[model samples]
Target: MNGKEALTPREFLRIADFFATNGYRLGPKIGEGTYSKVRIAERSNNGEFLAVKIIDKRIAKKSYVTKFLPRELEIAVLVKHPNVICTYEILHQGELVYIIMDYAERGDLLQLIQTCGGVSEKEAKRMFKEMAEAVKYLHNLGIAHRDLKCENILIMRDKRIALSDFGFSRLYLDQQHGDVTSKTYCGSRAYASPELLRGAPYDPRTNDVWSLGVILFIMICGKMPFDDRNLKLMLKKQMSEGVTVPETVKTQVSSECVRLVYQILDPNTDSRPGVVDILQSDWLN
Candidate 1:
């Protein structure tokens, strides 16, 4: 259906039927969102695993953006990279929309951080490198993963990282210069860039760098560098006072790494370094 159109009740039933025919044995719910619940599942033939993101068309049709679920699937399925969590199949039955994707057994980056009581200096750098590689791949495809928070970065069983969740991703035409200039404030408040919070034109790469900077800090410090009671205060702090890696962290990681973090999290997007700069940094390479 188009943005303005709605699916009928019969369409919803067909969507559910599609899943049953796909050989996906739905397991327990693993994640929940506004209109969907992600479930653990296995493909019947080879028993290869997958995560099934099932959304009720009825619930979505009545929600804001009523069309966001379908749009997200469309964009996600088009993006394929080794470091990116690939959307393998889409099953539309009745009023249900199902996205079957590779299952990351290790969960997300947040869980990995917690597993180590926060990552070590070496681990953080390695994680940063992997993340940079994935982001670079997306950028090359002319896609921007606007939401690059810890939760959106999944870790595979073998310890590799895969960027997931393309609900906020966008394709940047050459003329756009990679700017997320449109009025699209579409990510978690904690990781959002200043321009995003300020409601102005901004570059998505810089926005991603800002969030990655935060993740790097968290990985080393074992905590949020900026803690505020409210979103307003958080934005104020993020704008006025950029993160300062504690002296203790300096003992954990190199000065060059610290400098890299500061460069990325800089409140001003104009001065924020891009992924290329990060890849070229001694701390990264």
Candidate 2:
């Protein structure tokens, strides 16, 4: 453990006291962030275990508390899908905001991928399908999971994928009633599309597709599609006919599966397939 905590021991005690009043008993620390920490909480009434993300508004940047925090709260309530993490309750007291959600005993997809060096093609197919379905559901609701990554994809007790961490999520449609152009630089650079890397205004939906492709590639190949160390070269490879997978690794996975990843990773946003196309892919079927 780093031993550095967002919440001091006293702060945790204060929050625990607050939750007790709301029929919850805070337990062990399960997760954390720069400005917040997640603890497992038990409901006093029914003994249901849930995760409470305690965000300290005092420590967090003003812009986050005023902007992203509100949108995240709104999106958490609106997003209701089997494959997505369920936010059961949201409570606030003074400078602390509490987001209580389903407690997934298992860790995230990234941890699973790293531990096993990657799963078999069949396993990848099952996991990716769930991830795609979650993204599809969010898009249908005019919500964009702008930060889709292995880390954000949680592993439930059943080992099913539950897309989580919607701090970067946004309701993307504009007044003209269409996907709006994005200039805000959000999400990890490793999972970003060519347009996002270029710092240009682009469609967030297709950008999301590119990120999904990256995750799928990592799941099957056990590594990233491009090395971000050389940004220029990575962008060059992404835009060309170069095969993303290593020659040695290519022989292990099926050509069809590789093709599907390549298609979704297309740098040309116009040609990039959406979450729906990915869900309907033959490999997934």
**TM-scores for every predicted model:** 0.88, 0.94
lDDT of 2: 0.85
What lDDT does the true structure give each of the candidates? 0.78, 0.85
Q: Write the per-residue lDDT of candidate 1 for residues 1-285, one digit (tens) a residue.
A: 333224466854554455557776666668767667787887778777789887666665453345445457767888877788989888766576778898999999888777877887777787789899889888877777888888888988888888988877777555646344546788886787887888876778778888888888888888876774587887888877777888978887889988888888899877888888889998986
TM-score of candidate 1 to 2 decimals: 0.88
Span of 10 residues, lowest total lDDT, candidate 2 = 1-10
Off by over 4 Å in 2: 1-3, 176-179, 230-233, 240-243
The residue pairs found clashing in candidate 2 are none
How does model 1 fare in lDDT?
A: 0.78
